[model samples]
Target: MGIKNRLTVMSFLQFFVWGAWLITVGNYWFGTKGWSGAEFGAVFSTLGIASIIMPALTGIIADRWINAEKLYGILHILSGLAIFYIPQVDNPTLFYWVIFLAMMFYMPTISLSNSVAYNILKNNNFDVVKVFPPIRVWGTIGFIAAMWMTNLSGNKASVNMFYISGFASLVLGIYSFTLPKCPAQKSVVKNASWTEKLGLDAFKLFGTYKMALFFIFSMFLGGALQLTNMYGDTYLSDFANTPKYADSFVSKYSTIIMSISQISETLFILAIPFFLKRFGIKQVMLISMLAWVLRFGLFAYGNPGDGLWMIIMSCVVYGMAFDFFNISGSLFIETTTDFRIRSSAQGLFMMMSNGFGAFFGGIFSGIVIDKFFTHDGVRDWHNIWLSFAGYALIIAIAFAVLFKHKHYAEDVATVTH
Candidate 1:
């Protein structure tokens, strides 16, 4: 295979490992294990906690001491082992830590994969800006493929899901060893301060009012993403409890249905350039916030019966809801930040959304659902989704009122892919 194809395979398996377990784990926790929502919340929080703690540290290691590809491989190997151990963890608290361990090893690899790809592509004379997006899209396809494998094999709510994830991760880890090398920058690391090495220098952005609000909202919006990931598949799978819908395709294949969101995501990424040119970043982001409202509201009303289109439509809108803000936010950072700290600023953006945002979203959503949305061990999924919709609406209104930015088509033209 050519280098691009090899990189494509790497990208594919990178997310394939995650998709095997991520959406379906909620089903396993809530259905097979019969765990409490609050505990499951803690379980999901592992992603957030890992996101917060691991990426920057791993970046430092990849920069100073270890080759990026080797570090990426090691992390995946460790993550695979951690995941393989999860089925043996019968205790919820132990499961939380085990998953946390897996996430700590796994989360950093997402960024590391990008770094590895960028390094190899640049070295091979590929235009990363033009070539990378298509390569990265394969990761989404891999995620969809893994979801289908789990659902079709009837392992969506079983320990076998972890086995699938673990096996793929190990394979990817091994494959990573054969990829082109991305050596550490031994000399540059020697000159940078500890704070710069840790990406803490981006904290200076918070002193500016606009960037501060942007980071704050990014964190909150990130939490909203976790809310859906935590429950979307579980909600569909639980339709089996209702005799009227138990035989529905959705109930039988919730992971496959939820995979539609990832599908939409890939399509929406293609549409962002047009949207950014026409609507500018703030409007595009506002559109994303509104799209989130629609995503949850549709889920609140749609059932497997005649409202199947609503469920499908919600999945379609997911592409817009997720991609719009993330891409636009990245553009905002790219266009605004000083060149010296731009990379660290981007890291800060991920930290706020995927790290702190996901952490709070997982913790609070679980507790709130247990207290207000459960009755006799049955969940009020309708009210649950409506509450999430309300949360998105509030965030949308607040963003409109508080955050300010002026749009210049020329500015975005240079910055956008």
Candidate 2:
């Protein structure tokens, strides 16, 4: 295979491992096990905890000692074994530890994949900026494909989904061993202070008021990103309880409907360069926040009967809502931070958004739904969505006022390369 094709395959399997279980685990927790909301929240919090620590440790290993590709393979193989074992654990506590181990091995591979791909591409004289996005889009497609397979096979909540993901991970793990070599880059490196080595210098950027405000808002907006992932599939599957809409297409094919968001993501990612050039980072992110408000509000009013379009539209807007913040935020960090601490800055970004943000969203949403939205042994999903919509609106308005940026001509020229 061509180098690009090889990278594309690697990217696809990376996310395929995640999509198989992420969207539908709630069904298994709440519907199958009849677990409490607090327990489920604790289950999901593993993702945040894993994201905070694993990536840095793996990066350090890849930089100093091991070949990146070999480490990547080892991690995936261990992760596959961990995932395979998930079906055997019945208790929440044991389940947490198993998945935590799986995440420890799996989470680091995300960045390692990027590093490996970038190193290989640059070696082959390819442009990382222009070529990487198209390859990464396939990862989203892989995620969508996995979701569809789980839903269609009626295995969304079944332990078999883990088996399937494990099998795929095993295949990917073995395949990774055959990829181009990515040797350690310790020859030109020098010893440094602990803070410098750990990328702690990025923390100094926070002393500047503007960067501090931007990261603060970035953390809040990250909270919004997880809201849908935690509940989107469960919400659609809940429609099966309604007699009138029980047989509707969405309830039957909830994963396929949810896949539209990922499909839309592919297109929006390509459009990002244009939007960033035309509107600047501040405006692009503002547009993303407003799109998020619409994403949730439409869900509040949407139904299987007359409002199905609203549900679909919400999925469509998800592209803008997600890519606008995530991709742009990464670009913002890239442009603003010093090169030496850039990796750590990116880690901090993921820490705020995916780590703390997702942790709070899972726990907070669970409490709110349990306290206010559940009654008579049924969840009032409509009102629950409306409340979420209101929260998004408030965040959008606050973001608009507090985040100040000017679209100077130089802003367009800065990232043109």
Candidate 3:
């Protein structure tokens, strides 16, 4: 196979491992295991805890010591082993630790995969900017395929989903070893400061008003990011409790229905360049925040019956809510930061959005749901979604008021193209 095809397969399996279990894990937790929301929230927070330091640490190892591909392969294998062990544990606290270890192995590979791909592409004389996106899109397709596999095989809420993910992860881990080598770069400056050497210079951006506000909001919005991922499938599957909707398509195929969100993500990615050029970063991001409000509000009122449209629309809106802020925020950081600190700044962006953001979102939302949304062990999804919508709305209004960006059409046009 060609290098691009190899990378495409790698990308596909990378997300497939995640997609198999991510959306449906809630079903296994709430539906199969009958876990408490607060404990489950801690479960999701493992991603946040791992993201806080693992990616950067692994990046350093890949940069200085090991080949990126080798590191990536090893991580996946370890993560797969951890995931395979998940079904054996019945304790929620032990489950959290196991998943945390799995995340620690898995999360860093996300960035490492890109590093390996970019290194191979550049070495092979390909135009990375032009070629990478097309290959990366396959990852989304892989995710959708996994979701379908989980739902259709009657394993959406079963331990089998973990087996599917674990086996795929192991396969990908082994396949990664055959990919082109991405050796570490040993070009570090001898006179570099400790902060620079450690990739901690990005933290200094917190000293500036604009960047401080941006990172703060990134964390706040990041909290909103996984709310749906943590609960959407569970919410849809819960509809089975209703006699009329028990056999309905939406309830029966909740994972597939939720896959529409990933599909929408691919479409919205295509729209970003146009949206950025026309609306500027701030406006585009504001549009994303508003889209989040609608995303949740629609879910609040949606069901598998006549209200199915609202559910589907919510999935459609997710494209904008997710892509706009994430992609646009990266662009904003890229265009604005100093050349020397550019890479670190981007890492900082991910740290805020995925690290602190995921942590806050996972932990608090779980507690809040358990405390306020649960009644007699049943969840009030309507009020739950409404509360989430209200949270996003507040973030939008605050962003509109506090984020001071003067959007010049010429500036955006120049930067985008």
Candidate 4:
């Protein structure tokens, strides 16, 4: 296969492995298992927990000992086995631990996939920034395709999603071995310090006031990122119980409606260079924070009738809200951090945002909905969404006031792949 074909397959299966389960797992928990909000919250928290430690560890191994492609293949195979076992397990507690382990193996591969693609593309003398996004967009397409498959097959609420994921993962794992090898590079210093050896030296960035604030707010914004993923489709589907919306198009095709976010994401990713070049990271991120406010607030007032447009708009804005902070924030890290500790720095960024942010968001948001927002099993979804919107507003204001960024014209240089 040509490099492009290989990358297309890699990209497809990369997210296919995740898509087979991530979005619809809530359906399985709520619809099939009839589990409590708290239990489900705990289950999702595993992603955050795994994010805290796994990526850096795997990154260390890839850089110093194992070949990146081999490690990526092995991890995917192991994660596939974990997903296969998911169907057999019935206990929520056991399931949580098992999924946590699976996430530990899986989360690192996200970053590893980037590394694998980067190395291969660079080896072939391709422009990474330009070439990689189109290939990576296929990952988003893969995610949407998986969601369509799960919903259409009537497997969204069953353990069958895991089976589909497991099979795809197995194929991807075997295919990985055939790719160009990404052997580990020897360290320049044989007797590096423990911190340098493990890449823990990246933590020293915490001493810089501006970078510290950026990371801290990144955590808060990260909390908002998972909220839509956890509940957006389920929230829309909730209208199914109401007589007025029972037969609505959205109720029947919630996953497809949800996919507008991914479609929007592809467009936004393409536009990143223009926005970064024009606005700089600080202002761009501020726009992202405000965009989240619109994302949730529109959801608060939206329903299946006249309000459906608001919901769709919210999904549309999510592309900016997510890509602005995530991709832009990553680029910001790349620009600010030293080359030696860059990988570890990026891992730390993920740890704060996705790891800690998601853990707290899942548990707290669930508690708020169950305890304070629920009145007789039916949620006060409007108020819940409003509260989220309010949170976004506050975070945006705080970020604008506290973090000062000086925009350098040259800083906006477009990265060509």
Candidate 5:
């Protein structure tokens, strides 16, 4: 296989492991397991916790010691094993710990995969901005395929979805060792603080003006990102509560409907290079923030009947809402930072966005939903979605006002060669 093709396989399996369970797990948790909303929120918080603690640490390991590809393989193997053991846990609290452990192993691999792909692509004289997205789109396809597999096979709410995730993860873990080497870049640690010595200097990104604002907004948008993942599928399925929609195709196939978001991702992922090159990262991201507003607003008013298009439209908008920030943000970090700290920098981005963003988003959203949205054992999902839409809008306006980055063609040109 070509190097890009090889990286593409890695990307495909990388997210496939995540997709098999991520969107559907809410269904499994709330529907099959009958867990409380508050507890389920804690369950999602595991993603944030592990992301906060592990990514930068693992990036440091990859930066200073192990090969990025090797480190990635080891982590995936661990994630596979840990996730495979999840079906055996009976208590929600124990389930939380187990998921936390699995995520600690799993989450770091996400950033590591980007690092490995970037390393291999750059080494082979590929233009990263032009080349990476096409390969990355396969990751979304892998995610879509996995979701369909789980849903079509009647496994969306079953323990088997985890099995599906675990098995793909293990295979990818084994496959990773064969990829091109991405060696530790820092030759020596010297003349620096403890954070620098420990390869944590990426944390210093917050000290700068533009990057600080950028990351802050990224964190806020990251919160919006999970709002859908945590509830999109569950929301569609919940229409069953309305007798008129009880036997509707949506309730029967909510997972499939939700997969449209990932499918939308494929096209949007391809468009990112054009968007980034034309509009620059700041405007592109601002557009993404606005898309999030539409994403939630549509969902707030969407239903299984006449409003079905609104629901479908929400999923469509999800494509731009998701890809604009994540891919562009990572690429922006790639072009601007010192290459020695590449992996660490990516980890830091993940920390701010997925770490702090996800942690607080999960915990607080759950509490708010339980306290305000849930009434008499039923959730007011319509208002719940509108509240989320309002939050995204606030962030969009703030980002437009405060964050500043002029799009010079040369800014992105750094990696284009």
Candidate 6:
């Protein structure tokens, strides 16, 4: 197979491993295992905990001690084993640790996969900027496909979803070894500080007023990012408990219904360049925060019946809520930071948004839902979603009032070109 096809397969299975279980796992936790929301929140926080330390540590290891592809493959294989074991654990606390181990192995590969792909693409004389996005979109397609498979196969709330994910992860692990080599570049400066060597230099951005505020908000908004992912499917599926909506399509196929969010993600990604050009970064991001409000507010009123359009609209708005802030935030870092620390700044962005954000979102949201939203073993999803909407609104207002930036047409034009 050609390199593009090989990378395409790589990309597809990479996300397929995640897609198989990420969304519907809430169903497995709440619906299948009958776990408490607080505990399950801790479960999702595993991603945050793992993201906090693993990616940077692994990056250092891959740069010094191992070939990127080899390390990537090993991590996947170990993660697959951990995922396979998830079905056997009956205790929630034990399951948290298992999933945390799995995430530790799985999360770093997201960045490593990009590194491997970029390396091979550049080696083959392809323009990574032009060629890679098309290949990467297949990852989303793969994710959507996995969600459909999990739902249609009636494994949305079953251990079988983990089996599907585990086996795919194993297959991807072995396949990674056969890809082109990405050898470590071990040429460190003779006098590099421990911090610089570890990529901790990006933390220096916290000293700057703008970058510090940007990161703080990144963490806050990051908390908002995973709320829907954590609950949307479970919320829809819970409609089954109601007599009128019990047999509805949304309840039966919540995963597929929720796949609309991913579809919306693809569309919104295409719209970012246009939006950024017209509104600039701050305005575009503010639009994103407002979109998150709409995303959750719509969900608060949506149902599987006549209000299904609200659910769908909420998913549609997700594209803007997610892409605008994330993509624009990355662009902001790229355009503004010094070249010496740019790569580290990018890593710090991921650390803030995905790492700390996922952690805070998972732990606190779970606690809040358990404490305030749950009653007599049932959840008030309407109120739950409304609370989330309120949280997003506060973040939007704070961002508008406190975060400052001027639109530079030339800078945005440079980025687009």
Q: Per-prediction TM-score, please?
A: 0.91, 0.90, 0.90, 0.94, 0.98, 0.90
Model 5 / residue 341 / CA error / Å = 0.5
Report the number of backbone clashes for model 2: 0
Of the candidates numbered 1 and 3, which has the greater TM-score value? 1
Q: Which pairs clash in the backbone of model 1? A: none
Off by over 4 Å in 4: 412-417
Per-residue CA lDDT of model 2 for 1-417, tens digit only, reads 999999999999998998999888888877877777766766776666776676655655666567888999999999999999999998888988998889778877776777677668777887555676788788888899899999989998899889989998998999999999987654433676676555456667778887887878877787788778888888998899999989999888888899999999899878877787688888889899899989998998898889999999999999999988887777677567654444456656766677676667767887888888888658887887888888878888988898788775455443323
State model 1's lDDT.
0.85
lDDT of 6 by residue, 135-193 (tens): 77678778888999999998998999999999999999999999999876656677999
The sequence of per-residue lDDT tens digits that candidate 5 reaches over residues 1-417 is: 889889999999999999999999989999899989998888888888888999888989999889999999999999999999999988899999999999999999988999999999999999999999999999999999999999999999999999999999999999999999999976765677787778877878889999888888878888887888998899999999999999999999999999999999999999998999899999999999999999999999999999999999999999999999899999999998988888998998888789889988999999999999999878899999999999999999999999877788778879754
Residue 289, model 1, lDDT: 96
- Across 1-417, the per-residue lDDT of candidate 3 in tens digits comes to 999999999989999999999999998988789878899999999888887777666766666667889989999999999999999999888989999999989877776776677678777987554566667777878889999999999998889989999999999999999999888664567898887676555678899998899989998998999999999998998898999999999888889899999999888877776787788888898999999999999999999888999999999999889989876786677567654454446556776787788988999999999999999988999999999999999999999999998877566433222
Q: Which stretch of 10 consecutive residues in model 1 shows the poorest summed lDDT?
A: 338-347
Q: By lDDT, rank the candidates, best first.
A: 5, 1, 3, 6, 4, 2
Candidate 2 runs further than 4 Å off:
60-68, 181-191, 406-417
Colliding pairs, model 5 = none
How well is each residue in 137-209 modelled by candidate 1, as lDDT tens digits? 7888999999999999989889999999999999999999999888865554467777766545667889999
| lDDT value for model 6 | 0.84
The reply for model 3, stretches above 4 Å from the true place, is: 118-130, 180-185, 331-346, 406-417
lDDT at 384, model 5: 96
Candidate 5 error regions (>4 Å): 189-193
Model 6 TM-score on a 0 to 1 scale: 0.90
Q: Say which prediction, candidate 3 or candidate 4, comes out ahead on lDDT.
A: 3
